[model samples]
Target: MASDSDRLRALKAFDNTKAGVKGLVDTGITTIPSIFHHPLPLHRLHADQEHHFTIPVIDLAAAMGATTTTTAPSERAELVATVKAAVETVGFFQVVNHGVPKAVMSEMLAALQGFHEETVEAKAPYYSRDSRRRVRYQSNFNLFRSPAATWHDTLFMETAPEPTPPEEIPPACRTIVPEYTRLVQQLGRTLLELLSEALGLHRGHLEEDAACLEGLAGHYYPSCPEPHLTLGTTAHSDPCFLTVVLQNAVGGLQVLVDGLQEDDKKKSDAVWVDVPVVAGALVVNVGDFLQLVSNGKFKSVEHRVVAKSVGPRVSVACFFRPQGAATSTRVLQPIVTNGEARYRSTTMAELVRRYRAKGLYGSSLLQHLSL
Candidate 1:
């Protein structure tokens, strides 16, 4: 295994090259930093920099009681209450018995891994960072601007609103995970509706407001031979409304929680373990926009990825964001009139545009929405 300094130097070299920004797409080198010469330091989320975050785990079975879809008003209310608590407190939760089959999830993961392990030439075409394309892969968002680079490769696929045809997906894993994407997209829509209800908005309110919906199936493959020196993904927040992540069994995913001392910078116990899979559950997390829209009732917490010494880690993160030329200017209805005002009105387009201009820096989107 290469030392942290060695990995950082190589990544630094990659950052200097145009091909590095293009990631493995251009050079066809799975080990990105090798194209360059300098290794880059991993973005470590220490205790001092961490925040308080505890994701909720909700049971879909509660919603589907003996009453069925025509359940009485009170029963429905109870369901809504549980969902509301999950959204408001943790801004994330897992849904078990969500109706999507376990076989589908397993197949999806297998297909994703197979795709990542294919010959570099086979995956080169999808390597650009241009957000307009439904699918693309790149090393890191800060490719062009950041001081250093992260150690990971990604395969992004957008399938929503209009499902990306099965033919468009790579042939390597297509046969095995043929219907997996479609099933997850359906689940994404259902979850979005639930989020709408949780926000006290009319059912489908968020969906309609978001206009066209898009998703990115992010396949994060860890760096081999030198895991401890780098990261699969750096500490950052998603730019979309919500994200559904499917983590592989390797388990290096950790959420930074409260435990920091006022004067100390590193908090040993600040990081907490996130329960991976609970039989059948889709890990749902609120994004920056949702936090703003909900007036802080919901949160968009910061999380980071760490590299491991064991076998490679695989995670599929599906981001749900607005699309098309829909006016981004959606006025935020006040959530709290009393006590210091929390947020200001903003548009979906504006937020995304700003995020794009900034190029995924560590800055919080919430800062831009201050009253």
Candidate 2:
């Protein structure tokens, strides 16, 4: 085991490289560095149980009124019901025909992949730890704080509340980023509307009233030489209101779900289920704050990406949260619930502060915030 000081030095050295995991791969090292090694409990399921579950998939054409002049009341209601069931039970689902052009999605994914694959010199200029920078690239946002590092590098861009200026975007993906985010913002609004109705509130409640902002992260997980020793992403739940993700076919994403059988009474009977790659589908998952504001009616389940030996895996995730959450003084509580509030009322800033303190992969934030 490395001493504390030795590990810190290793972490700082890795960070200084600014080349990210891909840079390490470029050296053709057959073993991952000690910094990227994670502890066990990778949450492997029994072979028989691995393929037994899959997350729900929803078609949003009717809800978005894409095919007809107007969505029928029944069709809209059905859409909301599906969203409600998915959020409440699994907290994750995939959407097909969500109105973003498939071409645009492909372009964005390719552009991001291109950016990550660029020469280290090309990407180095954007490598930064400063949170204020709208566009930044780094290996792990919580590298020093986490118990172990993951095997991915991310190019994170804050695109909403204030859209990232096109000129500031990296040349590889600049043109497509704006277009992709615009369409995603529209899709996000529609989903929030459905979520609002699912909560038995006005259709415009989440989007128009609560007001959510957007943050995009383009994650590049290099092929891990020692896949079993590390994770592509640690098991963690998004802290925002919701997360929308687009992943390429090279899949490794998984969601941890309750696997308890009626005869089984153990509370720890949970399994890691693979989130299969669905062509032209975007994955959506509820986040911690959404679960809190819904008074525990909606679930915010933990999910993670497994490190794989196959090849580079690419995905883009867009996180939505209350606007000005980092510094806002506004307090948020459950909108309307039949029972007592499951979580204490708190401001986004405070919630975020606590989340950062715990780092990703910490115990459930909702449990700590419970009333």
Candidate 3:
């Protein structure tokens, strides 16, 4: 292992470049930097991923209807059942023909590509580390805190409670931002209501109880020269209530779904499964807060992005977090119980603060809060 002082110096040098992992790759790094090398446990499970099952893909076109009429009660109920099984077993599923237009998705992706592929000079003004900024681009927010950095850059901005001012959003993807935000916001509400019904509660329970629709964060994972040596994102779980992800066809996303049998869990190798990209579909995952709020009724499984020697991968994630005083003050209540409360009641703000402080290292804040 390199000396601490040397690692610190190397880290500072990389940060000063302000070019992110893409910058390093542009310089022709055949071997990944020491700072990007992943730990053994981080990579071990990925080796023998002999997955027999594909993730569940649900079609909601029937329920959405032609004229935007209310879904029939039976259709809604069936949809709820489909979603509940997927969440309980895999903690994720892809919804197709869910009302978002294909044209809108295409434009949003083009916008992401436009911004990330721009010259460093053009993108530099928005590169910042402060989460408070309405719009900023940067790499590895937990670079100083985590054991190693991942090979990805993110453009995080708030789109709900209030949209980020137009001037602040990067121009390359700016034109479609409003429409993308509007559609995803509608989708978030639809999913929350479905999830609420899945838990055997009224459709509005999750929305009224948790700030289920809040903001969006988008990431760009460019090709890595040393793909084997680093990860695009480490194994981690989302901290919010839900994440609606729009990803291009390049496909690097994976989720850890345990085998139901005890022998499966005992095996040293992981049960990580690939989540393939389907056109015009959004991948939804139950988050840590939702698991906590439901007292574990909905699963919050760990997921990660892998480094690839391909071209850029673009994905936009809409995080439906709690808003306003409810964000910090609301207590998590379980409408559907598994047994006793496995975790103590705490505010979303504290949980999120701790979650952010930990970074996306794959270590869950939920376990820490467990009784």
Best by TM-score: 2
lDDT of each residue in 247-346, candidate 3, tens digit only: 9999999998775444545434347788998988999999988898778878989998998889689999988886656677766654435568778878
What are the lDDT figures for the candidates, one per model? 0.62, 0.85, 0.81
Task: Give candidate 1's error at residue 309 in angstroms.
Answer: 1.2
Q: Name the lDDT value of residue 98 in candidate 2.
A: 95
- Mind giving the per-residue lDDT tens digits that candidate 2 earns over 29-74? 9988888877666535222263345699999988764543577788
In TM-score terms, candidate 1 sits at 0.77
Estimate the TM-score of every prediction.
0.77, 0.94, 0.93
Rank order (by lDDT, best first):
2, 3, 1
Better of 1 and 2 by lDDT: 2
lDDT of 2 at 63: 70
Please give the range of 10 consecutive residues that has the lowest summed lDDT in model 1.
17-26
The numbered model that scores best in lDDT is 2
